[model samples]
Target chain A: MSEPESDSISKGKDGLTIHTVSKDRLLEFMKDMKERGFNHLSLITGVDRRDYVEVVYHLHAMDRDEYVVVKTTTDNGVVPSMTSLWNSARWDEREQYDLMGIKFEGHENLKRIFLPENWVGHPLRKDYDLSNVQYINMDEDGEDYATFDQGDGW
Target chain B: MNNFVELNFGPQHPSTHGVLRLRAKLDGEIVRELEPIIGYLHRNAEKLCELTFYADNLIFFDRMDYVASMLMESGYLEAAEKILNIPPPERVLWIRVIMNELSRIASHLVWAGAFGLDLGMLTPFFYCFAQRDYILDVFTEVCGSRQETNYMSVGGVYQDLTPEMIEHIDAFLQSFPKKLEEIYRLFVKNDIFISRNKGIGVLSKETAIDYGVTGPMLRASGVNYDVRKANPYLVYDKVDFDVPISQKGDNLARFLVRFEEMRQSVRIIKQAITKIPDGPFFNPKAKKSMMIRLRGDGEYYARTESPKGEFGVYIVGDGGVKPYRVRVRSPSFKNLSVLPVLAKDQMISDLISISGTIDLVFGEVDR
Candidate 1:
């Protein structure tokens, strides 16, 4: 297999080569990288850049001992999931959805991960209101679970 | 055929280890599908670090993998140093290796004892803890804290190791092997232990990699991918030791892999202590200021082989006192992801054994 399109690739701040693929081409780019022996998808995280949410993929090629960072930006917070390509991306994508509000298309379970189901806003977003916090009532029943209150519990 | 019962294993049980709830779908005695419900111990570590100054967040790194705080601190500090382009002196690196290896042994001791307890053997728990206390004494003598030793700083470690600290470690190392043997004979050679663990929760080499399992769990599956050996950070490459691997991919295999790893850590500590050079522990330049500000926008990921697996830190600097973004790629988080796969089709009793072998520390997992 040939390398990812040269236009999609650039050097990152740490001197590791970073591939900034479009949201649509991410799965294909990841598959190609996996085929090229970048077998380990070490980390998957999202950074809320205000203008657009940036999803970062840290892939490690164990054979050649090379590290590559693949990042893609999404304005609408919808990006194709790489869970099909890498099993480790499953929880990571869910976490991104939970904390950064970056929706992963084709994710098997795209529900809230760390936060309670009743959480209103993604906490990691740059514009996330720290003052507009909600506390869950743990004593509530399962049917009435996580009743959000405007109290300063935390 | 449609009679599948859903069993909630734990959010409070002892075997689950630290507030982990597994919703297991069972067909009679065998589990069909197991989903791990985490986040009970979540403290939003990544988000919390972003709010704190670079130096101030080092203590929180200790809380991530509380069992092996030194290794976690080392990984975070290394990432910070990478972004700042600061290299710690040779003595600091060797001292870190000694501390990190001691932490490794301590972490593995906890795992060993817990694993034995999970397998219904109580004696090994006491044996392992006794040895672990000695290692903690060494940490206390050096860093002033036993478990949460926030000893590592951005440019270097917090304090220099004293002669008394070295002597304590030396004494521990001398007595550790015999204690380890007793535990080994009790757990490894025992027929009941083998019957409980061997060939149970067999995760194939391909499956382990596919699930991104690391450290002892991956090595137990016959993979030779160790962060210490693969990507050498700190003074790990300079230290001569073998990464023990087993092809069984079963509970027994994972147990043996970690059991051998404790010995390897001892070996590394011995060599690191003997070869530790006399020099400055922390970088003199960084010591001038309590707060460190990176000059430019940069991002770097640095990983160290923690006792559990590969503990990594990815930092994004916006040329500020505090990091723009800090993402911790905790090994337990990824390692715990494989539980559903490993637990599938296994007996309900064997689930405890499988989870024990994986060595799930909920602090890192839920982070």
Candidate 2:
């Protein structure tokens, strides 16, 4: 098949306009859109599709009263960060890294935001084992206080 | 010689409010750099929602922004209703507007009181709380619960407004203005309060938009963007209210914006009460116990103007009872992200006032 359009815009199931941009041209597309009045970066999140991860950016053009969702799918779970373009993307990118394991290259601080630094696995990934539970006792002092169990609650 | 000392502000400090830890690098009393460490109250609300049915997740929405539970519930229910393609009756819409505006007032009342306490003024705290209690009383009368009211459902509200509840709310509307005026006299015009907050923690309009701040904080920076006005949902389009804006973009600006917003909310509520038609509050077809099945393979995002800011909910349905993915784009999370930027080069003492002005509720921030 011939190469699909690098930048394709479609209306989402809801009212938002969805724009799918190629990973390589994502930064350029976002910059162009921003210059075109999509100044507000409302939300940045990721969806784990089992086969691949989809990174989603919700942008709003305040003056024009327009909202758009820019998304890109990645098999390797890595995408370019938009922190250089919008400061709002920093915390959100870190969150996507923590929960969905989608790494954003060139992010200033890419680390687990909601979970501990020593967290073993991403919780939102489909392959992660939810039954494997770990409990940390903050009152106790050492490794003995932290316990891991399979399908058990303390 | 330059000496920079690292200091920890919260996760326990009273002024920090709700377990927010700020690791600040201080040179003498002035802050050089600050980092906010969050997630202490994280309950994995987004992760847990994926395992729940459409209607069952409404309660979890309440837990996120406990200060403004009704607004949180409204956002989630609106998103689910959109995905399921269910529009509630006119009466339900009118009642929802009334409740939402009332919740907005209540949330602002708490903020006003807490913010006063943060500024070292105890009298205004009691005065604002006294008024807030009256609002909570009305909530309890209507929903049988005050703060964490899981009253909103997928297609409509869980209960209808009774005449006694209407009378109670009317009484509140009549008396709240006097109390608000008293609060204004107590703090808003006070010189000490003004001096402390007038120019501290300034966030410019460009900076606010770049960092994606919303609600009063964004409006304080002179941005006339409010979800209710920008994109009206429910009966907000019909109601007449002004979106308050300030050019100062400082602590005082944020305070004044919220104060004016409370008056506007009252205006919306009063209009809603008069315009609400006599009809069924809920859609007759919406069953109480049936699992709400959304359209397959579709994603929906819905947002509402909460007391704090724009609370958006994104849900993906896969033709199943449970959602494929549920994400809460909480305003507190985004607003708190700008703290480090705002606190830079400010006195360490100013950090408390700045954080208080941001009006963070860690439940929403950590979720």
Best DockQ among the predictions, by candidate number:
2
Q: Which stretches of candidate 2 lie over 4 Å from their true place?
A: A1-6, A136-147, B292-297
Clashing residue pairs, backbone N/CA/C < 3 A, model 1: none
The i-RMS of every model, in angstroms, reads: 1.3, 0.9
The fnat of each candidate, in order, is 0.66, 0.77
- Chain A TM-scores for all candidates read 0.87, 0.86
Highest TM-score, which number?
1
Local error of candidate 2 at B69, Å?
0.6
TM-score for all models, in order of appearance: 0.96, 0.96
Report residue A125 deviation for candidate 2 (angstroms): 1.2
Ten-residue region with minimum lDDT total, candidate 1 chain B: B288-297
The DockQ for candidate 2, computed on C-alphas, is 0.76
Give lDDT tens digits, candidate 2, residues A13-125.
Answer: 78778889878889988888788888889998799999999888999887787888988999999899999999999999998899889989999899989887767788888
List, residue by residue over B164-205, the lDDT tens digit for candidate 1: 788888888898898898889998678888898879999998
